[model samples]
Target: MILTAPVSMFAMLMTYSSNGSSSRPWVTPLVLFSLPLLFASLALRRAIPALKRSPQGSGDRSAAAVALCLGGLVYALALGPALDNVGVL
Candidate 1:
C-alpha cells in the first residue's frame, strides 16, 4: 500500500504536468483515486481490532494499507506546488 501511494501520487503529478492545456483536469483523477483510499482508510480504522485478531499476515496487511493511503494523501498535498506550477487547478 505504501508503495502504491507514492506511485499514484507520482502518476497524479505526471498527469498534471503533462496536461498543461487543461485547467484543473487533475482534480477529477485526484479525487477519483483519493476517494477510494479515504474510504478504505476509514474502513481499516474500524476493522483494526478484528483484523488484529486474524491469523498470519492480516495485521501487516492492514498497516501497509493504512500507510499507503496516508502517504498518498501526504504526497498529494506536498506535491501541490509542483502540480500548480505545471498547470494544475
Candidate 2:
C-alpha cells in the first residue's frame, strides 16, 4: 500500500510530463492511475493507528507516516497542475 502510492505518483508524473500536444488526454489516465494512489492513502490511514498501538510497529509507523506525507504532497502538487492541464481552473 505504501509502495503503490509512489509508483502511482510516478506514473501520473510521467504521464502528465509526456502528454504534450494531446487534447483532453489526461482525464482517463489520471482516473485510472489515481485509483491505486487513493487506495494506498486510505490503507495507510487505517494502518497508522494500528501501527501506533503495537510496540513492534514503531518503525512501521514512521514508514507509514513518511509514505502518507509523500503521497499527500504529490496529491497537493498535482492538483493545480492537473486542473490547469485540463483547463478546468
Candidate 3:
C-alpha cells in the first residue's frame, strides 16, 4: 500500500505538472481522489493491529484503494474537458 500510494501520487503530480501554460480541470478530482487514499493510508498505518485482526478488513482496504484509483482516472478524464472550458488545460 505504501508503495502503491507513492506511485499513484507521483503519477498525479506528473500529470498536473505536465500541463504547461494551462490548468487542468481534472486537478480537483485528482486532489479529491488522492486525499482519501492519503487519509486511508494514514489510518491503516495507525491501526495496523485492528486491521490485521478483522477478517474482512483487508478487503475493505483494498476496496477503498480501488475507489481512490478510479477517482483519479475520473479526474484525469474530467480534467481535459474542464481545462478546455476554463482555459487551464
Candidate 4:
C-alpha cells in the first residue's frame, strides 16, 4: 500500500505532457491510489497492537491524508460543479 502510493503519484505526474494533453491529471490518481493505503494502514494498526502508535503506519497515514485532501479539492472544484450543473449534487 505504501509503495503503491508513490508509484501511482509518479504515474500521474508523468501524464502531465509538455503539450498539455496528458492522459490523466495527478489529483485524481493520487487520491484514488492513496485511499487503499489509508484503509490498509488503519487495518494494520488495528490488527497489530504496536502498529497503532508506531512508525509502521506513518506512510499509510500520510498518504491517506494527502489523498483525502486532494480528492476533496477535486470533487469540490470539478466533480461537484459538474454534478450541480446537472442537478445531481
Best by TM-score: 2
If ranked by TM-score, best first, what sequence of candidates would result? 2, 3, 1, 4
Stretches of candidate 3 exceeding 4 Å from the true structure: 1-57
TM-score for candidate 3, please give it.
0.35
lDDT of 3 by residue, 1-89 (tens): 34445665655576555544325445544454455556655654545554446467577656555655665565566456556657665
Tens-digit lDDT string for candidate 4 (1-89): 45566776666567666676554454544555465545655644454553344464577556555655654554455555345545576
- Per-model clash counts, in order, read 0, 0, 3, 0
Arrange candidates by lDDT, highest first: which order?
A: 2, 1, 3, 4
Name the regions of candidate 2 deviating beyond 4 angstroms.
1-32, 35-39, 55-57, 87-89
Q: Would you estimate the TM-scores of all the predictions?
A: 0.33, 0.44, 0.35, 0.29
> On a 0 to 1 TM-score scale, where does candidate 1 land against the true structure?
0.33
Write the number of the candidate with greater TM-score, choosing between 1 and 3.
3
Clashes of 2: 0
How high is the lDDT of residue 22 in model 4?
58
Per lDDT, the best of the predicted structures is: 2
lDDT of 1 by residue, 42-63 (tens): 6656556655565667666667
lDDT for residue 6 in candidate 2, whole number 0-100: 68
Prediction 2 global C-alpha lDDT: 0.63
Model 4 regions more than 4 Å off: 1-57, 87-89
lDDT of 2 by residue, 10-88 (tens): 5556555464555454554455447656766786677678567857757777776776777677566657657777778
Off by over 4 Å in 1: 1-57
Give the per-residue Cα lDDT of candidate 4 at 57. Answer: 55
